[model samples]
Target: MADVETLHAIADAAASLQVLIQDAIEWKRQHLTDDLLSALIAAEDEGDALTADEMGEQVALLYLAGHETTVNLVGNAVLALLRHPDQLELLRRDPGLDAVAMEEFLRFDSPVQMSRRITLDELTLGDKTIEPGAFVVLGLASSNRDPRHFGPSADRLDLGRVDAGDHLSFGGGHHYCLGAALAKLEGQTAVGRLARRFERIELAGEPVYNGRINLRGLASLPLAVG
Candidate 1:
């Protein structure tokens, strides 16, 4: 069936990406004596060392955490702009708003829609008790739309919002994304340039979405620009 093939294709793609990341990490470990790789190597105790397979998995996770997050940021930003004309025009005037704009954009349409975590022990959130081994799925997008955080205009795209970064798009606390700065820079560069150059940029047709609920993004966006 096509469905089974598609599932296999997705798995194959993930596996391929993992291999690529593994290869790069291995190459660097072989050549470079940098602190990051060195630290990873140093973490190994005398009795326990990082096996080849373990190292590969670690490197793969690192690559996805860094690479996939940025890809989503840019893709989601473009989709947001295409849908909101007023915000796009406003951004064209003030290039400096790129940073805040990205924050707002991320809040409005978070690239990674959901995150999962297992409670270490019995925990109480509000009135409910989360038992150990319970899986919790936090909806980042829904939280961004929370009236308490952004007030009544949470759903509205306000580029000049004072505290747009208050959203949990990049998450919070110790688990916060490591490559946040790099991702922000890339988004700012791309969006800022596009704003300055294009006199008129509009979607040519209905944009195709990736159809993955966890990753709300575009597969292909047909746009007309002048």
Candidate 2:
């Protein structure tokens, strides 16, 4: 009974969030005429264009996926730096390392911990054979830390890691995140600027987790910056 009530509450909160996002999408549709939504609406592929609902869905997806991922990326990066003052100092000394550092951050603590994919055909992975139509959840976080792909120091955060960008934080191929470039730019700018401006940064209290399993992030990160 309690579990059912909790699930209902969660569903209610999600619905409310969707409403808020849709409202914002509508507002953007009306007021803004020069953004991604507008572009998507105006986009044509061999005379085929997206309908109103399709455009709305695209915008909502961007808001849902891009917004939280970027927020969590920045938050997680800052938290990592705070925990590793030496690395933070290195970044403060050389802001150019932001791009590499961002890659390492994504690899060390990916915002999207896992991704889902439906098997189109029977496939064998190790000893397990997944039948067609089976839902497969790939552990992106685990893959990022895989020693075979990332070498001996896979678990460590090395900002200057030459192969850091090889991580699957943004996925790959056609299904790669559409807003990957934007997210990287925002993360680099935000974390780099923060490092450059703040002489000191420290956690003020215990951080609060979002409690989401797939999307790992903090709900609140109390900090003192100077």
Candidate 3:
């Protein structure tokens, strides 16, 4: 069937990424000294119970998580600035607000849209009961924009918000995203670079969105810079 073929294609891409991670790890072990690979190897040597396959899985996870999320965060932040001229001007005037600008940008259009978890037991949420084994998709984007939590114009992108740190874009609780700090740093760096370079930037065309509903981000965004 066509659906089966499409799934196979996706799986193949994922497998290829895994292979790339393995190759990168080998390269690091040969070329560089201290890095994520080195840290993982050290942990393995220190009586860590992970098998070879498990170690591969760990590296694969890091590669996928770190690569895709950081890329999306930067891309999404650029897209946001392109859409909002006023916000861009604000950043242009006050360069020191890069950190706050990045946070506000992320909150406005998070690279990661949603994540999943299963109900451990029957838990009531509003009128519905999340039965055990029920797959619950947490909408991080929606939660970030909740009017009750973020005040009146929850959807508005305001860089001046002092408590911008409360956004659920990085998730919450147990799985609060390991690469949160790294993603923020990348966003800050990329946005600062772009702000310094272009006086005005606008979207040239409609952005290409990933078909995946879970891993939401722009696949491509053509921008008109001036």
Candidate 4:
């Protein structure tokens, strides 16, 4: 447990990082380059360039999405594999199952548990009628385990499951995750490489959760690998 002072320090550090990201966005706007930041800065639709604040927000989102989400994805996948040895052994036996295994890992334990959305207009979903501007929170993790979509054994991890890619771990529609492909590649490579390099991998002690309500991942995972 972190003390009040430590919590304050963490908050301050996060604020500082936000400032730095905004500064970088402004810097990139002036000195346009071929990188992602420059591309976002210079992006225009029908000669309508993005506002400075919009650019900053987009850049910040890209940074966090590219870094934290992928870290959590890998961590959650490794933890899931550790918990399910049979699945781990199956993956170890067939390295070619990396892609599908990645999908199962994502479905079994989504890094992002929820997403918030605002109603654009009055909408009726099932029994509930949501008015315009109403706030809606989607439970992505729960959706992944939905028996209607994933069948009766949805709770179980099956690397060979074909419909595992249908999971909403990467979101859907226009607001889908921008770094989805990159994240998947990173996760596949990390899990596959770790399994290939380690003949025996076991948990050294109990894993510690990050304690974040939205993001699910391990704060520290002790592993014994040979």
Task: Write candidate 2's Cα lDDT for 52-153 as tens digits.
Answer: 556556666887898999999999999989888888999999988999999999999999999999989999989989999998899999999999999999
For all candidates, what are the clash counts?
0, 0, 0, 0
lDDT of 4 by residue, 52-101 (tens): 66665676778887888889989899988888899889989998999999
TM-score of 3: 0.88
Which residue runs does candidate 3 get wrong by more than 4 Å?
30-32
lDDT of 3 by residue, 1-226 (tens): 3598899999998788778777876776667566768888777768898766777898888778888888888887887777777878888888899998888877888778888898889999899878899989999888888989889988887888876778888888898888888888888988888887887677889999876676677789888888
**TM-scores of the models, in the order given:** 0.85, 0.86, 0.88, 0.86
Task: Flag clash pairs in model 3.
Answer: none
lDDT of each structure? 0.81, 0.87, 0.82, 0.87
| Cα deviation of 33, candidate 1, in Å | 7.0
Q: Which residue window of length 10 is worst by lDDT in model 2? A: 38-47
Which stretches in model 4 have alpha-carbon errors above 4 Å? 1-11, 22-34, 44-48, 51-53
